[model samples]
Target: MRVVSLVPSLTEAVAVTAPGLLVAATDWCSHPSDLDVVRVRGTKNPDVPAIVALAPDLVIANEEENREGDLAALRDAGLDVLVTEVRTLEQAFAELERVLVDGCGLARPGWLAEAEAAWRDVRAPSERRTAIVPVWRRPWMVLGRDTFAGDLLARLGVENAYAGHADRYPRIPLEELSAAGADLAVLPDEPYRFTVDDGPEAFPELPSALVSGRHLTWYGPSLAEAPAVLGAALRAARG
Candidate 1:
């Protein structure tokens, strides 16, 4: 079955589960680092004509990562599109199953089960900390209510300070974020590459947990290692 994945996590999922199934993927689909496929540009602005020309049996995307108009254009060109919505870890698992087993017509992958088992025993730390999680810097967008990353952090004993905001990813002012009464700042390395020098300095007052964006945000094979990887970062930052 020929498939084209627009979401990076889904691209890795499909590539890892069923190799050679993907005829094309977005430029941002960087996992399985050796992935060799037709690059269809970035997730938000994929080359629609290029994707259509590939003649994939199915095109995969996420409701948040991909644009509606792009998906519609593919569907209009007589291609089957599977759009996924992942707001929490559970949704991630279910959606992964939907994409691989149901959508790609492949048997459930063993890695999916291993990923599930990894998070099965994760219990929140007794003393939870509130954090201001930033996804971007110039406009200062943050994790607001009902986000997959926020849910993952909560499971790991960090609560998002802006979880009550109406917007899923609210663009707050830098000054306001610094004053948000959060115990720390949880910075991921993607959507914006937050590094030791770049991000922590912004929140000078709060301890900065520079975490991997893949483990914190991407829901695929990395889920198996996210807990341990993220937990150590948070611990080191807190100490």
Candidate 2:
């Protein structure tokens, strides 16, 4: 199909659904392992001219990741672009369904049904504890308001604790996290691997756990299996 993907999760979808069909992708697009064989075009702010010259039949972008200007430039170049957005677990499923059914011409896998059944296995949640998930390092921000991750946590019966913030991922003082009195501050292990051991030493008062970032955050084919996994983790954490 000569697909060029600027977003990582979409890249994962294309690679998983139709391997070797991808012409290029951002440096961040890594999933299903085999996609590692594809050529790296660049990051989210990819070289548009380079992509245009690739002469792709389909270009995948995200409403959240790439800048509007970048996407507009591609549109101006007359390339067919598909933009996906993921803000909730349901929305994640919808996006994946769109990519598979519309983009790749594949049926939704049975894993989604399995994931739903597994979620049904979960006992009705009784609590909504607070947590702060750190998605990045340097300036130090938490998964705040209006993010897919934040909404996923809410689905698991946990609150962002910083949901009313001005930014989806606002850089906050570390001390403010402690003041939030979160039950746990989850540390994601992709984009940066934060281990459970590092938890005690780093954010002492707040019990912590190392988690797969994509599982909780990436909204694509991965969502087919996420609820079962994340639901289990939340059940365990509350125990």
Candidate 3:
């Protein structure tokens, strides 16, 4: 079955599970770098006409990464679109199954089970650390309540400082975030590209853990590595 994926994580998921199934994907879908699919543009502004031209049997998208209008446009064009909602690790696993098994009519991939097992093996560190995770820098938005990344960190004994905030990604003042009483600040490399030089300086008082955004925020085969990848980064930040 031919598929067009708009979400980066979902694109990687489908690509890894079933090779050559994807006919096209967004420019942001950077995993499996050898992926020779047609580029359909970015997630926020995908080329609708170009995607329709691909004649895909299924289009995979995420509710968080894609715009409703784009999905509606595809549906209006008589295309079957599968939209996934993943706010936590469990949701990601279940949704990946639904998108692959139910939506794509493919058997469950073995990697999915491995990814689940990897996360299941995670045991929270005895000493928990209060963390403030910043996703962006210019306006300074943070991981707030009910975010998948927040839940992942919580499992590893890193509590998100803004987990109780109303907004899932809230824009807080830089000064406020710096003084939020977090023992550490976790910075991811995407959506904002936080580097050791760029992000760590903002919170000099707090130890900074510069992490891989894909591992920290994305769900897919990466989920299997996220626990160890993020754990090591978070652990090193304390040292």
Candidate 4:
């Protein structure tokens, strides 16, 4: 079956599970770097006409990464679109299985089981650390309540400072975030690419954990390694 994926993580999941199944994917679908597929466009502003021209049997999208109108347009053009909602790790696994096994009619990849086992074995720290996770730098948008990243951190025994906030990704001033009295600042390398010299300086008083955004924020084969990878990074930052 010919598939066009808009979500990067979904694209990686499908592509890695069954090579050559994808006819087209967004430019942001960077995994399996040697992927030889037609580039539709970015997640937010995909080229509708270019995608329709591909004549894919299924178009995979994420409710969070993609716009509703874009999915509607694809449907209006008579293209079958599968939209996946992944708010937590469980949701990510379930939605991935639905998209790959049920929707695409492919055999469940062995890696999926490994990923489940990895997460299942993770034990949250006895004493949790309050973390201020910044996804973006300019205007400073942070991970708030009910985010997948927040859930991942929670599993690692790191509670988000703004988890009680109403907005999922809220923009707050740096001073306000520092004043929130977080024990550590969990910084990822995407959306803003926070590094040792960059994000650490903002919070001199708190420890900074520089983590892989793909592993922390992305839900895919990376989930299998995220538990180990994220735990080490968070621990190292504390020391």
Q: Candidates' TM-scores?
A: 0.98, 0.87, 0.98, 0.98
lDDT of each candidate versus the true structure: 0.94, 0.75, 0.92, 0.92
Residue-level lDDT tens digits of model 4 in 1-239: 89999999989898899977999988888898999999988999999999999899999999889999999999999999999988899999999899999989999999999999999999998989999999998889999888999999999999999999999999999999989988999999986899998655899888899999999988888899999999999999873
Write candidate 2's Cα lDDT for 55-143 as tens digits. 88888788888888888899999998888888776677777778767876667756555555654555546867788788776667788
TM-score of 3: 0.98
Q: Could you give candidate 3's per-residue lDDT for residues 130-214 as a string of tens digits?
A: 9989898778899999999998999999999999999999999998997899999899998899889865578888888989999
Which pairs clash in model 3? none
Write candidate 1's Cα lDDT for 1-239 as tens digits: 89999999999999998888989999999989999999999999999999999999999999999999999999999999999999999999999999999999999999999999989978778999999999998889999999999999999999999999999999999999988999889999998998898655788888899999999999999999999999999998873
Candidate 2, position 186, lDDT:
76
Error of 4 at 140 (Å): 0.5
Better of 1 and 3 by lDDT: 1
* lDDT for predicted candidate 3 compared with the true structure: 0.92
RMSD of 1: 0.9
Which prediction has the highest lDDT against the true structure?
A: 1
Residue-pair clashes per candidate = 0, 0, 0, 0
